[model samples]
Target: MGIFGFFILAAAGYFLYRNYFTTNTYETKDERYNAARAQRQKELDGLLDKINRRGMSSLSERERQRLDELSGK
Candidate 1:
């Protein structure tokens, strides 16, 4: 029973290490930058659309700050 429990713990540790510590080897720096830029653009577009539908006053302070940050203010 002791050896069985040790093996179980070792397997769980290895699974956690593999999931959290391992980095993706296929993603290059440029790829990561492009992905981030695209995501920012998507968020900016959504915020702009919301403003058009409702109004600037509908945005929360955090959302306004995020919009400014994404827009490079």
Candidate 2:
């Protein structure tokens, strides 16, 4: 095989390996925002559930602080 052919194949293999092995690469800002939003939504759901079942007034001081933080107060 010609040197040029070997070089082309090696370049393709390197690219394939890099693509397969690289950690997550965010493609757009929206992707990053969505991930953070999902996490926050999950946290809010759990917090709301606790408040509902236990009563907001019954929550401990720490739980109240968490709720306030989630509400951005």
Candidate 3:
């Protein structure tokens, strides 16, 4: 092969090696976060159910605190 062809092949090989070895670790973390979010949403849904049945005023102080803690606000 000519010098140019040899360099082209070398670059291609290097790119292939990099592409093969790169880690995609974010997907696993994103899945965990999605699961936690879904669980939190379910908990909030339950709380809303309580509110619907018992009225918002019926929420105890502890329940309000718990809601605030979960909401981080």
Query: Which candidate should be chosen as best, given TM-score against the real structure?
Result: 1
* Poorly placed runs, candidate 2 (over 4 Å): 1-24
TM-score of 1: 0.64
Cα lDDT of model 2 by residue, 9-54, tens digit: 9999999888877756746888888988899889888989987898
Q: Using lDDT as the measure, what is the rank order of every candidate, best first?
A: 1, 2, 3
lDDT of 1: 0.93
**1-73, model 1: which lDDT tens digit per residue?**
6999999999999998898789556889999999999999999999999999999999999999999999899
Writing each residue's lDDT as its tens digit, candidate 3 over 1-73 gives 9999999999998997777767554568889999999999888888878989999898999988877877778
Error of 3 at 29 (Å): 0.2
Error of 2 at 25 (Å): 2.7
- Residue 55, candidate 1: alpha-carbon lDDT: 100
- Per-model clash counts, in order, read 0, 0, 0
**Ten-residue segment with the worst summed lDDT in candidate 3?**
18-27
Candidate 1 ranges beyond 4 A from true positions: 1-25
TM-score order of candidates, top first: 1, 2, 3
- RMSD of every candidate to native, in Å, equals 4.6, 5.2, 10.3
Model 1, residue 33: displacement in angstroms? 0.5
